[model samples]
Target: MRPYRSVLYIPAARERALEKAQTLPVDAIIFDLEDAVAADEKENARVLLARVLGEADYGGRARIVRVNGLDTPWGAEDIAAFRGAKIDALLIPKVGSAADVEAVARLIPDVPLWAMMETPAGMLNAAEIAAHPRLSGMVMGTNDLAKEIGARFRPDRLPMLTGLQLCLLAARAHRRIAIDGVYNAFKDDEGLRAECRQGRDMGFDGKTLIHPAQLAIANEEFAPSDAEVDLARRQIEAFDAARREGQGVAVVDGRIVENLHAATARQIIARAEAIAERAI
Candidate 1:
């Protein structure tokens, strides 16, 4: 139940941003060497990031590197450079199939792999991609998906629902971490909060963010509230008492608490505890 509440992307080429990220209250940092870096700086960014990762102590923050796609000229080299580097995961962009995961897995056997689910083919074959044994997470690439599918911007994201839901379903079915796409409006705090709430309600583990300004809202929206935590504790206690008396169900605030509900309650408590522990 590790927290994936606020995953921020920092360009690998920017030394100052990389140094500053070590202090940000983010659950994870995506050391981006793909979309964020210019073509000419790709090789230099990879080298610089590898050096920073070795020397920096980011505490409990998960350090994941987003590499260019294998189809790109710099992709294979990016994968090779991080082969022995200390990283939690290697994020492969435009991953359309399990074979795409295998291509990178063979090179970096030690670290876990995460996929950028963006293209139409990727959405349709999400099950196979999520089922890959080495894959640990799936990130929604909403901007790219919208561009590829010719979708217009809408507050509700009606046009992007199918692709978002498809990848989400696959990630859950395979028990992989599912993170929603970024909200491009970095300055729009209210808009970000609304989308974060929507993603949380849809069962995403967290949301990917493009800027540091988006971190606080994301961490708040994805984490369990005090009221929710209290209810979970009460539900568990009530369920335990009911089972002791040969009862199969317990009532909490007029809602039935069965084995399934108790199980969910336990998970909520565990997730909250994990987040607290990370803070420490």
Candidate 2:
């Protein structure tokens, strides 16, 4: 799995934001042309993003462009503008079903696709959407989902739990990355940290950000902690020793360690390595 701890969203229309993004320490950057760019500025945003893709050097960070939906007048043109451009993925907004993935997949060949899981239909058909061959990731669109379901926003995201899990299950089942929704209160570091921890605990690979300030919190929360890494290493060592001794189980910190536990520990260690490598 990719280390997508912090994915920042930058309006594709903002030249300064696009340029400044090269210096930000983010795992990925979503060049948003959907809600972030005004309808009147859609064409200009597309042109600007295409130019940025050609000229800018984002350096190991994944570049994803969120285009307007095909139902909109600007959607086709948005796809057309980025043809052959160097972007890692195309994020389709308001994805309702597998057919929605296919619709965009047909137009953007050789590019991985990401779906926004926001609407009721999208959540209901998440399994099918995730099964699409070209699909690589899913981003939870909690704000739009709240509006669609008339759900009241709570810090715990009690109302959005079902949808979040549904999408996450599908993404994991299909080996695709699942990113948590953005916190609306960008300035509230405590609120953002709480939400990031919740998302990470709930099994989201990462959280999307509306502002760069949220990057540090998201990155810190999603990463494997030093204590966790140390524990994982110890668990792996104990389990390997037990296996060599023809034993099926080992004890770590007075708790039983088995093959399953060792496997999880290895994954944690590998994830930590991946994050470190990306940083360098």
Listing every candidate in turn, what is its Cα RMSD in Å to the true structure after a full C-alpha superposition? 0.8, 0.8
Instruction: State the C-alpha lDDT per candidate.
Output: 0.95, 0.94
Deviation of model 1 at 210, angstroms:
1.1
User: Which stretches of model 2 miss by more than 4 angstroms?
Assistant: none
Q: What TM-score goes with each of the models?
A: 0.98, 0.99
* lDDT string, candidate 1, 1-280, tens digits: 7899999999999999999999999999999999999999999999999999999999999999999988999999999998878899999999989999999999889889999999999999999999999999999999999999999999899999999999999999999999999999999999999999999999999999999999999999999999999999999999999999999999999999999999999999999999999892
The C-alpha local distance difference test score for the whole of candidate 1 amounts to 0.95
* Model 2 Cα lDDT, one tens digit per residue, 92-114: 99999999999998898978899
lDDT of 2: 0.94
The residue pairs in collision within model 1 are none
After TM-score superposition, the amount by which residue 57's alpha carbon in candidate 1 deviates from its true location, in angstroms, is 0.9
Lowest summed lDDT window (length 10), candidate 1: 271-280
Worst 10 residues of 2 by lDDT: 76-85
